[model samples]
Target chain A: MAQSADAKAYNAKVYVTLRPSVLDPAGTAVRSGLSHMGYDNVSKVRIGKYIEVELTAESEVAAKSQLDKICDQLLANPVIENYRIEILEAVAV
Target chain B: MAQSADAKAYNAKVYVTLRPSVLDPAGTAVRSGLSHMGYDNVSKVRIGKYIEVELTAESEVAAKSQLDKICDQLLANPVIENYRIEILEAVAV
Candidate 1:
């Protein structure tokens, strides 16, 4: 659920990452390619996605809960990925 | 709108891009930096976002429309960005 018209505005940054146990071949390929291209100082590499979502919500807690539902039930693949979300901006109704 | 449990499984790859007229300083920085670092093959640069979404949808067309709504109304800044979505996989119900 989102929010009613009277709710405040909020911006969320959702980060999705592959689970530690999952093999990220794409990330590995990118890192190896960078190294070959002379970026020797580069260390470990992990690939993730960044999603920015805007919502109108009643409160921070309510907003976070709604976002969690979106992530767990709709966005990220729970079996292979873990996600973290941060509230980037909040504005009064 | 999504599909019922009896629908097929669909995976989507959504690409979000800044409109051609929009300024992308971050992309500029990356491209210039890469050229300076010897990736001279690079020409123009535009920074964008990619999202992978999995869903149960009745058909490809329905899934695409749902994803379009999500992108146009929720995910992208229509004033400055345009988006394209591709159906990557589909499995029987």
Candidate 2:
């Protein structure tokens, strides 16, 4: 596969979740709701954000670095939330 | 490895995104934000929900079936949102 080092499209899947030490009241409410719905199997529930970003970069490394900055600046709150990123080459459809 | 068939713990990572046919105004807003922040490399952005549900079930099959119902009834709306589920055994930390 011929690759372009100058400009390549990439897609990023980012998951932002609360740090383990932080309390998630909404999650607790969901757990209680599940219990009320007779879903006794539910033990815990944590809600977070899933973001898909499409961008063009020179390489995977470049894309990753940019995404890290993007997440830190806008996608996630670094103090109480942690973000994970996965990048994939953009395939032409 | 001895495993309990009656009751076992599992964690479900559910990603809820808008259907392809639907428009993501929030994502567009974020993309604009990135552009304004001088990240012009970004082409598109789509924001979605990431739900972490911790539950106990008899088996993977049981866990999946129950989760399908839960997502359909509570976690995700079938009309505009599409949800994907990834289940992993809850490891003791």
Candidate 3:
């Protein structure tokens, strides 16, 4: 990958999951559904959100900083959810 | 980790995303929102699903097979969405 003098476009993959202590009704429902569908071996289920964001940043460090703020402020609810962000290498845009 | 003679409990992570050709109105909306919130460097956004499931199967191969069917039948819509499943190491249950 070639570097530009200015900003580069980076793709970030963010995964947001609920805290272990929080109850997930939706996951419980899905687990029940699977059990009824004859997948009785299923024991637990948890649902979360996956987001991909493409942004321009001056450097990889800048991209990560921006993504961290974005995840905390927008991509996840800090009260009950935790988020993990992975920023892919710069891509031509 | 030691496995039981009959079945071992496997942890699986499933990621479901829309096909590249599909229109993602929600992601678009989020991008716009980010732009409005002073994150003008943001270029694109795509939203998807992340799921974790625990189930018992005779082997890792069987766990993957069962997950494939579950994703096809219930977790993802084949026409518009694509899914990737990863089975983590077995855990005692």
Candidate 4:
């Protein structure tokens, strides 16, 4: 079945990062690797996940809400990470 | 030893995403999962890596150049993924 004409497709960019107080072993490993590669000036390496979600909604507001809900509920762990969501341009399906 | 006064610490936000033409099994799996969870409107889910590197450099231009090099050489696979680099505000150590 085809999507409705009123349904707008959006690309959501979600950024999930570790909170300032948490310890990041993966970030430490990456920092060490950079140091070994001669990027000695590099420090405070924090790594995170980037998720791009495409979905169809009635409007941008609805899309934003859904993205926010997903980020808070599934994409990020609120206790240890913070999530930022951006709604990109709407595209045709 | 302390960093020089001229060395400004900047946060680099690197986003690495797979090329649109490439097959994204991880993304497909996530889409399926979302669908199974009742998000039938969700589709085209792409997964990527977000890296935050805090480094001390003389200027924003220099920091951007270094980030470009790192993304091209080590952080991202040029063959399948494209990367974007952003230099954020300088932070005090």
Query: Which candidate tops TM-score?
Result: 3
Indicate which candidate wins on DockQ: 4
Model 4, span A1-93: residue lDDT tens: 235788888989889999989999998998898888888889878889999998898878988988777777667899999999988767665
Clashes of 2: 0
Docking class of 1: incorrect
lDDT of 1 by residue, B1-93 (tens): 334666777777666778889988976775576456543433444556655566556677877876686677655689999888888546565
TM-score of 3: 0.92
Interface RMSD for every prediction, one decimal? 19.6, 5.7, 5.0, 2.8
Q: What is the TM-score of chain A in candidate 3?
A: 0.90
Docking class of 3: medium
In candidate 4, list every pair of residues with a backbone clash.
none
Off by over 4 Å in 2: A1-5, B1-5, B91-93
True lDDT of residue A11, candidate 2: 89
Candidate 4 residues lying further than 4 Å off, grouped into runs, are A1-5, B1-5, B91-93
DockQ of each: 0.04, 0.54, 0.56, 0.61
Clashing pairs in 1: none
Ordered from best to worst DockQ, the candidate numbers read 4, 3, 2, 1
Task: Report the error of model 4 at residue A78, Å.
Answer: 2.7
Displacement of residue A3 (Cα, Å) in model 1 is 4.4
